[model samples]
Target: MLLPRCHRIKQPASRSLFQSRPAGRLFIFMKRIGLTGGIGCGKSTLVDYLIGQGMCVVDTDQLAREALSPGQPAYDTVMESLKGACRLEDGTLDRSALGHLVFNDDKKRRWLEGLLHPVIRQAWESRLHTWDREGCPMAVVVIPLLFETQAQDLFDHVICMACSEKEQLHRLLQRGWSQEHIQQRLKAQWSLKEKMDASDGVIWAEGPLSSTFQQWDQIYHRIVSP
Candidate 1:
């Protein structure tokens, strides 16, 4: 991808007195961009391209995994809520087992979300603030449930990656996922049409990778420009 250099970065805006405090305490304003897409829409690939274009990117999926690691607060809360229903003999939580418990059942899914979302939100906010303090020009947040979670308001702009249902299914199958698993994961997310309607911009990912990279380049230019 060949992205235009950021005009904003070349011309730093003047800061208010509040932003011109002591070096260690000074604050910097950075754009918060939300990147979302449906399952199998190649969102990770898009984020990678954006990162290559010099945008600081945060992976919510990776953070979610971190939030549930053995010693994490949310992990302890989840274990207490599940009460050994999702635990292994070795005392660690069985994530695959827990996934089966919630993915197929809406009530259980909501219950788990209730337990985890708050912690995830807290962590996300802290990271955002830290990045802002460090003077990052802008950042991209890779959120898979941006629409479903009603988190669009959290970002200055939202980008949705999209593909045809057939293409999505084919991509999932290529990853060796079963048909049932694909359907279940799809059921867990809003449809592509819904996400596109709610997004500030859309990147179509059904074509070749080269074409997708070209779209990414265009988006990078738009994002970094005023």
Candidate 2:
């Protein structure tokens, strides 16, 4: 399947302080594992399971949020580009508002990604470097757009979490997402089939939580012992 041209690396913006670096060359000592899946696909559940087992988890979603906070790296640029359409009266970013605009428009979505991905990658690389220096064995990075951003090369291993389409839609509905909104978000990502095909491992997130836990346990042991 042909991915959108946005999935490929583009020329760097000259004024941006953050730049993408090759993860493989930057952190050779630590085992870096990338976790990704479609929206509502239970990637977070797997991330939490890994965290409970004492792995350091770097969440790109969280980092992106931080990057957009008032004084952070991406804040000023976002405000300037979005022209206050996604900002609150009190000067905070209205995430839901921004999400609505971007999800419905491919150009806007790619623009936002172009603004944020470099900053996010820089932050993730910094954390990985710190972990390596501190003698950490492995770190799990939760990036929802790992494959879309062509970030699979950044990790020693990559895991794609997935479930049936029915289950995915149901889960998103439970979280108060409208069916249309969910579909739009899903459309922005690589299909689960493609992600699973490209990944080093796959975790089916269909069944009960205990079943998911058991699958995670097996993967954990394999990563640690193999």
User: All models: lDDT?
Assistant: 0.76, 0.79
What local lDDT does model 2 show for residue 159? 77
lDDT of 2 at 187: 87
Instruction: Give the clashing residue pairs of candidate 2, or none.
Output: none
Model 2 lDDT, residue 149, Cα: 92
Q: What lDDT tens digits, residue by residue, belong to model 1 across residues 66-94?
A: 88888888888888877878878887778
Per-model C-alpha RMSD: 5.6, 8.5
- The digit string of per-residue lDDT tens for model 2 on 66-183 reads 9999987588988888787889988989998999899999998999999999999999999998887766778889999999999887776787778877777889899888989988
- Cα-based TM-score, every candidate: 0.82, 0.84
CA deviation > 4 Å runs, candidate 1: 1-28, 88-92
